[model samples]
Target: MTEILGLYNYWIVIFLMMTGFYIVIARENLIKTIIGLNIFQTSVFLLYITMGKVTHGTAPILKASHGGESHGVEHGVEHGAEHGHELHAAAEGHVDLGVDAVKEVYSNPIPSVLMLTAIVVGIATTALALALVVRIREEYGTIEEDEILEMDRNS
Candidate 1:
């Protein structure tokens, strides 16, 4: 229960998802539908970004944190020194990293990269939709679905 309570990011994502879904389904206007799609897109982005985040973590390019700085590394090296070959390896500059020194908490980048692609696709889709809407308006003088339907029937 307490653990679930701590996950507020998930809660926010869920809320956004529901709201976007409602807008996409309930709206009648073409412009409103696009706005709803954008909201839905934003919710998905938030979800991806939140999932990619690491708690007390750093970028993958940086060294991993083992709770503290190189303090853990010193202890690990001292331990390795007692292990014969490990000491020799260190002396030759061929440093063998211990578990503590290699402990990493990197933010996974796949989600962000995937989201970037999604954003590009979304932009293209939105531009296409707006262009179609503009063309429709020029031909029919209105952008509403009901009006278009009535015009189609009359024609």
Candidate 2:
């Protein structure tokens, strides 16, 4: 299952996205509409998160705690403590660092960064919409679009 998931995760995410889009477009109730929108947005996030996942690739950020670079320097280690700098050399149990593993298997970082910005935009839109809903409810005593329409027609 893991193999299949790793292979076709993009298709699954696309399917979810289409389903959520259909729900958002077909729904009528205002609150239900908002829920559908949330689902659609979440599906997009899932797609990005799925793409960001790498089977063996390391994280984008360099951390001191993970013994990546700074940790090696602080441990009073010799020149070859961390597998040395030879391009063809491999660590005790790991693959050689000469090969560009990140470039080969990992998705691009630009997409991940763009998706994070999109998520922030989605959250901000949702919050602003909710605030508008609250204001509309206070003014009309109802949050339903149809009810608001009826009130407008009667007035």
Candidate 3:
């Protein structure tokens, strides 16, 4: 039950995705189809953002030392020592290069950045689609797919 509850965001994403898909497939109106596409896009964005989250995580920001001497290494070493651990090299057989192991857990920023780009692209695509729909309405006096098909058949 706890495991299922923890995946609430995934459930929401699936629901929105199916709803959007149904709207696009079952509706005949051009406007409704565009709205459905937008819904689908939103669900994808939500999924990416949700996947990028980490438990008890923070933004990946490195704090610089006020003085030019220590360079934050002392702080890392002190933190590790406080936790009853020693900072070690990341790999075996490699010399300890004095690099501090950052114990902070940080959420990945890539998914959010990619989603932002996708949102801009989605908005541009939707605008183009709506403009095309308007032109279709002007030409056929209707935006219904069935009506448009009937007109095409009669012509």
State the C-alpha lDDT per candidate: 0.79, 0.68, 0.78
Which pairs of residues collide in model 1? Answer: none
lDDT of 2 by residue, 1-155 (tens): 99886668788878888887887788576667777787788889888777777667656653334345344333423434555563223242233321323344544576679888998988898888788888888999987778899999999
Deviation of model 3 at 58, angstroms? 3.2
Candidate 3: C-alpha RMSD after superposition: 8.3
Per-residue CA lDDT of model 1 for 1-155, tens digit only, reads: 88687788889898998898888898698899888888888899999988988888766554534445456556656866788678655543323344444466678888889999999998998899899999999999998989999999999
The CA lDDT at 59 in model 2 is 61
Model 2 alpha-carbon drift over 4 Å, by segment: 1-7, 61-107
| Candidate whose lDDT is highest | 1
Stretches of candidate 1 off by over 4 Å are 59-104
Which run of 10 residues does model 3 get worst, by summed lDDT? Answer: 89-98
Scored against the true structure, residue 96 in model 1 reaches a CA lDDT of 35
Best by TM-score: 3
TM-score of 2: 0.61
TM-score of each: 0.69, 0.61, 0.71
**What TM-score does candidate 3 get on C-alpha atoms?**
0.71
Tell me which of candidates 1 and 3 scores higher on lDDT.
1
Local error of candidate 2 at residue 88 (angstroms): 24
